[model samples]
Target: MAVLPIVITGEPVLHTPAAPVTTIDDDLRSLVDDMFETMEAAPGVGLAAPQVGVGLRVFVYGWIDDDDVEHRGVAINPELWLSPLSTAPLHEMAESEGCLSVPGERYPLRRAHRVILRATDLEGEPYEVAAEGWLARIFQHEYDHLDGVLYVDRLDHTNAKTAAKAVKRAGWGTPGLSWMPGVDDLEG
Candidate 1:
């Protein structure tokens, strides 16, 4: 498996809704493998297909829970259900989020603390995961990519403006921009 170039913000694929993964062929498996590698290299808990320039409803995630349990897998054409988010004030860094597509920028945004993620596995089997805490956030973040949404897009007025400025300063306001994980000295 190889680390693929992760598309930056403003890329059409990142903004357009991804198509469902209909055929579970060897090629799709290979892409899953590469996505895992890319995610590892990106040092991110999750990575979505559109972020890697593939317009498919797929994403890979790897995270260790507070109990020392490891959760890692690929979600193909996944559907997610989330619990209501708290209206309480965000705890600065504790509630902030970042994205591989919009690298190196993070801002506070409220998200459901729990989520139910359902999707097919690599072997064409269906499965569901009940996740909470950071894992839940990861699922929501990646799922948003499939629907052509980014975390920055959900930011409030002040944060949204700041995120846009960050994107502009990073020279990522246009299309056709990408960064190769493990090669590019950057992080999300």
Candidate 2:
């Protein structure tokens, strides 16, 4: 597997909803492998296909829980069920979120406290995960990419303005985006 270049914001693919995976063939498996390598190389907790210029409903996640246990997997054509936003913890409201597509930025955005994610693995076998806290947040963030939504789009008015300025200063927001090498060096 090889680490793929991460697509930045301003790319049309990042704003368009991803297509569903029709078959779990070897190519799909290879893509998943590449995604995992890319995510790990970028050293991000999660990544979506759209972030890599692939318009397919696929994502990879690698995170360590509070218990220090590692949890990693791939989700293809995933469906997420979120708890009401009202139930999110008060502390989470102050937490900042970032994305691979929108590099070097983090904004505070309210999200659900829990999520039930259903998707198939590389082999087309179905799986489900019940996540909460940071894990849930990661799932929600990546899931948004499947629908062409970015974390910046969820920011409040003040933070949105701040993000806009930063994005503009970074020379992003154009129709095209640049790719960055070294996953661990990514700011998102």
Candidate 2 overall Cα lDDT vs. reference?
0.85
* Best-matching candidate per TM-score: 1
Those runs of model 1 whose alpha carbons end farther than 4 Å from true positions after fitting are none
* The 10-residue segment with the lowest total lDDT in model 1: 179-188
> What does candidate 1's lDDT look like per residue over 1-188, in tens digits?
88999999999998899999989999999999999999999889999999989999999999988789999999999999999999888887988989988888889989999999999999999999999889999999999999999999999999999999999888886899999988997673
In the predicted model 2, the residue pairs found to clash are 41-183, 42-183
In model 1, state the lDDT of residue 20: 92
lDDT of 2 by residue, 1-188 (tens): 88888887788888999999998898888888888888777668998998888999999999988799888999999999999886444453456888877777777788898999999988779999999988899999999999999999888788889989998898898776756558245474
Off by over 4 Å in 2: 87-94, 183-188
